[model samples]
Target chain A: MSLRRRDFLKLTAAGPVAFAAAATLPTSAHASPAPDNAFDDAYGVLVDTTFCIGCRKCEWGCNEANDVPRRARTEFDDKSVTTVHRRPDATAYTVVNQIAAPPETPQPVYAKVQCMHCNHPACASACIVGALRKQPEGPVTYDAWKCIGCRYCMVACPFQIPGYEYAKALQPRVMKCGFCAERIIKEGRKPACVENCPNEALTFGRRRELRSLAHQKAVASPGRYLDHLYGETEVGGTSWLYLTGVDFARADLPPLGSRPVPELTEKIQHGVFKNFVPPLALFGLLGLVMASQHSGENGGK
Target chain B: MSPTFRRLAWGIVVLSALHAPALRAQKVQTEAEQRSHMEMMKLDCRQCHTCESPTTTTPCLMACPRLTVAQSSGKHVVSEAPESMVLDKLADQYQGVQFDHKLHAGMAEMNTSCSTCHHFCPPGKIPACVSCHSIEANEQNLRQPSLKGAYHRQCMNCHREWSHDTDCNVCHLPVGKYAQAHDKTDPTDIMGKAHPVVVAPKMKSYVTPYAKGPVVTFYHEEHIELFGLRCVDCHQKENCSYCHDLSKPQAQKKTMEQVHSLCSSCHQNAKCSKCHDTVERPAFSHASTGWSVGRFHSRLECRACHPTGKRISKVNRDCTSCHGGWNQSNFRHAVTGLQLDETHASAECADCHENRHYNLKPTCAGCHDDKRDFKAVPPGKYVTVSRKR
Candidate 1:
């Protein structure tokens, strides 16, 4: 009797509404107010693979800038590492892979790979505790404080980015390129990799301008380029774009359809969790049945 | 002036003014001027300037054209260019680059001349890289690389060939660390250093994919010393990667056109057997033809007599071995400086000498029983009256 029927009904009705509001909070709190796939003003990078000489100078600069375990600048002269292709891992946020090119190419094409920084990141969508986030300016960031070691974002990324620190006995971070978000957003400077590139292979600018620049590059040199800008329309677009001389797959970038990965799963799967509505409805039905039984027992008595 | 005269004068002025610029634009260049301009390349001005009238101030220039005519390099000589230049325009983190201009220009003679580095330069003057490649990259014109990028691309195109070592210390010393080193002895340090002699291989034997006689022996020394061919004449547009690539296999895949391009420049009409033979061909020798270019002909170039091409020395040949047109009547004695006497001139030709053996001195045993002292007493008096020979 102390748990009154009116109070319980009110609680059930109000709970789901509050939960729905909280579930939608992350997008408004962190992401750009712009509609999906339209981050025209957001920062972006254009990677021209043809200009990369596999110098590894950018890698040295990045490691030093990010406060990772770094070697002397002169040690980057060991270009033998370029002979073997590599992907970004926990230690390094960005890596340049010397991939096979057409036989006519004088040197093998080098691919600089990092997080694509997707416009609508599936990693952020899949993050259960809201640790992973897509910032308004262009970076898809991660907060270790809220991560809870779920590793769901790892499975969610289309680029196969976001490596985890399994070796650490204590707290391990879900590591990936931060897009030098602090430097870019706060200091208004270029990313260390872009600044250090000898050939200016990595050009940074507004995402919209970069798309046009990539298009112009292909158009200007029709023979030099493949006429396609990867990450432009792939997976609803990305902050990082690539102008490749060869096929995108040859550069280690998988050909993804325009429709985002999260679009397939979010509506149904996330809809169930968005509000406490489904659980509340299920319990409300059960509550109604139990109450009816109790009232029937009282009449029988 | 009459009214009609005034009208005609106005019309003439207007017509000339309208056609003035058009005439200049379509002015036919001379053979020399056209030669300097690579035969007036890029006739369509739109390739360089986007607009109709590109002004000096606004020059709405596109980036350096893709097919930048390197032919203008002929206008530049090593003496006319700067000896050395300290490029400090954009130097910030590192010290200014000590570019050995004369050294590089000297090296350019072996490559495509000054155009090897200075790919685009208009007539009359050579503008510095900063003239076209501005401080920042032209966002509109992605074709022109930024100043920093331009400098790096020019240097690294060759240095990058090392594959392992594009070590910045080779060119860029830490600012304070290097400036003092150069201050001590500025002239001699890398700034004014000359290009080291490129030690070329004596010969290169190519086992080509040709079905008929595959070995193509190129005698590098013979081509240089005997044939008198300059390095640039043959090694045009040589690829640095072709020499520096360490990972590539021994037998690189060159197309048939590419493999033959170097030899075809001089050996255009040469038979395949001249180059491609079962065994390496011996160095060319005039002695093999029973004419040793020994003492008198040693200084003569092969082309002095041979003249190259399909017709081998048929016309414009220097030697005087054949005088088929010469006869007793047409022959002039004073020119040879032994004017014949009346009796000697009246005698039948070949009475004392063979028909074609006029170079030989003959005996006078046929007419006068005396010594054949033609120079002193027998023939005619010398024209100049001195025993010069």
Candidate 2:
């Protein structure tokens, strides 16, 4: 009985050890089926901060377009709102924040904070049930019906852009700037904020061309703009880009690296569950050991 | 191909055609050369005219000249420009801007000329802003600013430097509603605001920071009236923002170095006391130096007698200092209202001018026994001459 017990322990330990080793190998049997979203001709917006007048009309336009509650037209004229820095919230999809500049300069820097609509959004990667999807057409779209209300997406967003409808007791959903995806992708119209801009500071075009345009503008007017383009490679490049006169850090725009956010987590998770081979091997060995042990016991009887 | 792709190709051809002149610009007249010729006439009729004289009816207009964008302004005086212009092309939400055309053109003359705003034009013509900049932004060409952007950029470039006011009401009155209810009789209701005509100061006195001497008096008119300094000689260094910056309502205090920089070109080697004093100094006078610059000398420029260098050397009280070269042959004594007789004509200058002191009256007692004065019994007959005080 002691010898049989030792044999059972050896078999069980060896099975798991072999299974663990197999998981480390790159699996050909269970290749990921996630759609390739590295699109080249995706639409984007180029924001020239040098031209922005900080009118806050873009905020009003965003509210009107996204079905968010809007105030009277005159409300946007109240520039005192810029006295305090603001963030995009559940009620509003975009907010223009006034950055402090040298008092002598006539042009004041304003940053329009919104969802970056990253090519590889961490929010979509964090969503366990696929409620948030990085659409091939260049938007991280959310489906409220499919959402389990896990709220992981909110925590995972690098820009802290995702907002949860915590006020709603039922049918609460995650909200963010959808980049006016329906208008841009389907109807082929400019985003409401871009259309409403009096200065035409926001330019909507192809991502590749805009990238070149942003660089060209910076190079052409070296004194007017800093060399840095904020979203060119941040989290593998966002659909929206910024051209700022001030330093990116001073403009409230953080510099993130070129690596995609999903690359690391996908590798680790995909490795463990690849082909379900690890679980199968461990269970198959356990059943065989128990049957052999039972037959030995019967013989002993 | 898609319609959009075809349109892009067409746009490329159009843009290339617009800039085609730039490629063959070797034979084109340089801007400075054009300006030199244009300076002779206020209006650049020469750009279009093949003949020297262009009449009202027969301008003698040449074939359209090959002109570059830069040399096209051919800037003229403010009088040639319209006093005011009504810009109504893009006026949708606001009233047409009643732009004081002459006022802006006048200001531009102080620094850059018409080329500052009139960036694009034919060789002789001053085209409207709408001529080149399209109503809609050119999607195919990113360099070309739309009409709206061009208008705002031109105004805001300089206005923002001084006023820093991007408010719509600054330039445009609202079109509809209570906004159009302007009072016609009210003085403030006048459209096309004008800069108050600047009255040049005669003099300016300041109590400066110098410990030894505080008061500094500047003779503003005398520099131009007496010294013959043009306004551009000193005014060229400073820009409009020096006085017009609204954010800084009060003019800034300057350091000694900063103050001297403005006057350094002329007063490079001047002493501190030359400008600064414990009390405000009076305007300069030759009388104070014990030598009166008489009517004839007063008409002459200060540089004519004084050394035109770092320091102005004083004229010696003795007449010989400047008139040393003058002798019997060159003196031409007839200028003194006396035509010398045969006897005195051959006499040495010292015979009448004792000790060569020409300031003193001539002494006749040296030759004549009878006591005769030069005023009564003259050496020669008096001739009518323009020898008046």
Please report the candidate that would top lDDT against the real structure: 1
Residue B222 shift from truth in candidate 1, angstroms = 9.2
Give the CAPRI class of candidate 1: acceptable
Candidate 1 lDDT, B16-54, residue by residue in tens:
999998877654433344444444453445656687755
Name model 2 segments beyond 4 Å from true: A1-40, A102-107, A128-137, A142-149, A168-173, A273-301, B1-74, B103-127, B156-166, B173-192, B211-215, B222-253, B277-389
Candidate 2 on B214-233: residue-level lDDT in tens?
98899989888778775656
What's the lDDT for candidate 2?
Answer: 0.73
Q: C-alpha displacement of B124 in model 1, angstroms?
A: 2.6
List clash counts for every candidate, in order. 0, 0
Candidate 1: pairs in clash:
none
All candidates: DockQ: 0.23, 0.13
Worst 10 residues of 2 chain B by lDDT: B63-72
The C-alpha lDDT values of all candidates are: 0.74, 0.73
